[model samples]
Target: MATEHPAKARAPHRRPFQVATGVLGDLMFTTGVLLALLVAYSLWWTDVTVARHTGVAAEHLRQRWSAAAPAAPPTGTADTAVPPRFEADDGIGFLHVPAMGVGYQVLIKIGTGEDTLAEGVAGAYTNPYSSAMPWEPQGNFALAAHRDGHGAKFHDLDVLKPGDPLVVETRDRWYVYRVDATLPKTSKHDTGVIAPVPTGSPYTVPGRYITLTTCTPVYTSLYRMAVWGSLVREQPVDPDRTPPPELRKEDPSNG
Candidate 1:
C-alpha cells in the first residue's frame, strides 16, 4: 500500500464583516475615551489652574497698591487725591456680583485680550468701550469672561435678573449697577452689544453702562450671552466703610 500523508491543516478565513466590526469597535472605544478626557480637563483641571493664577494676581494687585500708597500730608496741606490710570494687564478693580455669587469677587484686568484673560477673571474689551471706566463720565465698560473654564468667572451669569446687583470697586469708589436687561443669545461678532449704547438695548442716550459678555449655552461658543445695566449708584470709598448691603448676603430665599 502507498504511504499517505495527512492533508495539510488550513488556517480559518475571517469574513469581511467580522474584520470590519472589530476595527470599528476599537475606533469607537478610543473616541469615547478621548471625549471623556476632554470634558474632565475643561470642567475640573482648568478651574483649578485658573483659581491659583487668580490668587497670585490678587496678591500682586494688593502689594502694588500698598507700595504706591502716599504718606499723610502735614496739617494745612490739601488731600489732593488723584484717580488711578490702569495699564494693560494691570488689575483695575474688583467685580462683585451678589445674585450670581455672594462672596465671589474677580479681578478686572485692563485689556480683554488673551493675556489679561489668562491672568485673572474678566478683562475690559479693547475696542469701542475699552477706554471707558467705571469712574468715567459716559461710556460702556464692556467686560468678557469664560462661562465654563479658565476661572469660569461668569458661569452662573444666566441667573441674573432685573434688579440684581452688580458692583465694581476701584481705589476711590464703588460703582453700582442694576441688571436692566439680559440678551440670552446674540451673534458672537455682534460688536453692537458692546457699543456705547448697546444696539438692541433700551438705552437711547449715552450713559454710564456696564456690559458683561460670556459664551452661551454652557460649553458651546456659537453665541454670546450678555447682561447689560446702567450705573445707578456710586460712592467714594472710605477705609472704615463696609461693602454695600448686597455683597454681605445671598439668596437663601431662592432655595
Candidate 2:
C-alpha cells in the first residue's frame, strides 16, 4: 500500500481576517459618534451667541433714549406733551409685570419692515397690513413674538391670567393695561374675542387695546395664543412719583 502524503496543514489566515473586520467596525462607530457631537455643539453655540447680541443691542438703544429724555421737558407740564405717534426705543424703559417677568424695550416701527422682527426678539413695530397697533385707540393692536426654545421672548405670556397688569413705559408716560381674556387659535368667524371692546361687535373702541400674540402649544407654531388687555389707566412719569394710567373710553367706536 502506498503511504498517503500528510496533507499540509493550512495556515490559520482566517483569524487575521476576523481581526481586521472587527477593527474596521469599531472605527466606523467612533466616526459616527464624533459627527453627532459636532453638530450638537454648533447648534448650542449659535443660540447663545444670538441671545448675547440681542441683549447688547437692546442696552445701547436704552442708553441713547435716556440721554435724549433728560433734554426734554418734565412730565405733566405744558412743555412735556405726549406725542400722538409712539417711539420705539432700544432698551426696555419699564417692566410690565413682576410675576410674568415680561420686559423688553418697546419699538415703534412703521409698516412692518423686514428688519422689524429680525433680531431674535419681539418686534417693536406692528404688522401694518395684518392688524392695528396695540397702543392705538382704534383697530386691533396686534403684537408678535417668538415662543420657542430659540429666543423665548414671550414664552411666559401663557402664564398670564385675567386681571394681570400689563405696563408700557416711555420716556414721559406709563400706560397700564389689564388682561381681560385669552383667545385660542380660531377661524375668522371667531371674531368674538378680537372684536373691538365689546364682544361680537365690528366697531373699535376709543380706549387703548393691546393684543399679545405668540406661538401656542409651547415650542411649536401649530397655533396662536393671544392675550387681550384693555387700557385701565395712564400715569405720567413724575420725577418723584409714578402712577398707573387710568382706563378711558374707546374713542373711534368703529375701525
Candidate 3:
C-alpha cells in the first residue's frame, strides 16, 4: 500500500540571473553606506578637527603678539603706512565679523590654497601682489575661506548687509570695514573679485577695500560669493587688548 507514496519534493533551484542580481544588490547597498560615511566625515569630522587645531593656533598667535614690541603708528603716507612686511607663516591677523555670530573670529593666514583654508582659517590672496595687509593704506585686503565645511568661517557671509562691521584685528590695530556691496555669485575663475580695485561690484575706484570670498550656495563650490567693503577706520589696540566699538555692538545680523 505504501509503494505508491509520493517521492520527496525537490527544492527549486535558483536561476543564475537571480543569484547575480542578489549579489549586485548587496554590493550596491554596501557602496551606498560607505559613501554616506565618507560624506559624514567630510562634513562633520573635518570641522571638528580643524576647529581644535585652529583654536590652539589662534592662542599661540596671540601669545606671540603679546611678546612682541608695539608697532609705531602709521605716518599717514601710503609708503609709511605700510607696516613691516610679514611672511604668511607669521600669523598675519584675525578677522572678526560680529554679524556672523558671537565670538566669530578666524585666523588670517597668507594663502588661499586648500592647505591653508582647510585649517579652519581665512587666507589672503597671494597672486603675486594681489592682496594687501590690513596695515596697508590703500589696497584690497582680499581674503577667502570655506563656506560650508572645515569651520565654514564665512558661512554666514550672506547675512551681512550694508553697514555691518568687518573687523581685522592685528597686533597693534583693528582695521574696521563697513559692508557696502555683495555679489551673490560669480565665476570661480574671476580674478577681478580680489583685485586691488575689485570689479563686478559697486567699487570702481581704487581705495582701501576689503573683499571676503567664499563658495556660494553653501555645500557646493560651483561658483563664488563676494562681499565688498571699505575701510571705515582703524583703532589702536590698547594695552588692555580691548576690542573696537564695532565688535562691542550687539550682533544685529545674526538671525
Candidate 4:
C-alpha cells in the first residue's frame, strides 16, 4: 500500500518540452549551414566569371591585331597624303619584337576631351590628366598593363633590352622604334619617364618616341618598369609589296 503512492506519478507530460527544444536546435543549425554554403558559392562564381570574361576580351584583342594588314597603295601614281590620326577601330597592322615573342594591337584614343581608353583593357600608364595623348607627336604615350601572373597583358615587357625592335602598324604606315634604355621608377627625379618624348630636357627630338611601362619585378606593381624606344624606321604600307617573312605573319603565332 505504501508503494502505491508511486512517487506522485513523476509529471509524465514534461517530455514534449524536451522534444521541442531539440527540434528547434536542429532547425537553427541547418539554417546556418545553408546560409554559409550560399555565401561561399556566390563568391566563387563571381571570381570565375570575371576571369573568363577577361580571357575572352584579351583573345579578341589579339585576333584583331592578327587580322589587320597594311593599307593598299593608290590605284594610280604616288600621291602624298598625310594619314589620319590613329583610332581603335582601324586595327593594329604591324607588330615587331626580336628578343621575345610579343605582339598586340596598338590602340590610339583621343587624349583630350573624353575617356577614350578601352574598357577592360589595360590603359597606358601615363597620367590621364596631362594635355598629351598616347599618339600625340610630343605628348607622353604611356602604356599600362596588368602583370603576367594576373592579366598578363604585357608580360614580356621586362624581356625587352637595348636594340630590341618595336614596330607598330597603323592603317597606312608602320612606325618603328628601337629600344634605347630602361629606367627604374624613382621618386626624386623628374625625367618624364612616361612621357612620349622627354620634355623640359635639353635634347630636342622629332618623330615619335614610345615608352613601355609595366609593373616592376615581372608581376608586381610595387614599382614601375619602363623601356624607352625611339623611332628608328618608317615604311609605307604597300599592298603590292610582301611583308618580311617575320612580319608577314604574326610572330610567336600566339598573342
Best model per TM-score: 3
lDDT of 4 by residue, 157-207 (tens): 777777777766554556667777776554323436655455432235644
Candidate 2 Cα outliers beyond 4 Å, as residue runs = 1-47, 69-95, 102-115, 128-139, 187-206, 240-255
Error of 4 at 175 (Å): 1.0
Model 3 whole-model lDDT (C-alpha atoms): 0.85
TM-score of every model? 0.85, 0.60, 0.86, 0.52
Model 1 lDDT on a 0 to 1 scale = 0.81
lDDT of 1 by residue, 134-175 (tens): 867789989998887788898888999989889998765678
- C-alpha-based local distance difference test score of model 4: 0.52
- Candidate 3, residues 68-120, lDDT tens digits: the string is 87766555522233466767655788999988988789999988888889999
The residue-level lDDT of candidate 1 at 250 comes to: 61
- Tell me the deviation in Å of residue 80 in model 1: 6.8
Give lDDT for model 2.
0.55
In terms of TM-score, how similar is model 4 to the real structure? 0.52
lDDT string, candidate 2, 1-255, tens digits: 876455645454468879999899999999999987876675456457657866776577556665664535544523344444544533334335533642333333333243444444555433222444433445555556566443455777878788877776655666677777776564433334444453532235545676666667774667777778776766556664344422212112321
- The segments of candidate 1 whose C-alpha lies over 4 angstroms from its true place after superposition are 1-14, 70-80, 251-255
Quantify all predictions' global Cα lDDT against the true fold.
0.81, 0.55, 0.85, 0.52
Best by lDDT: 3
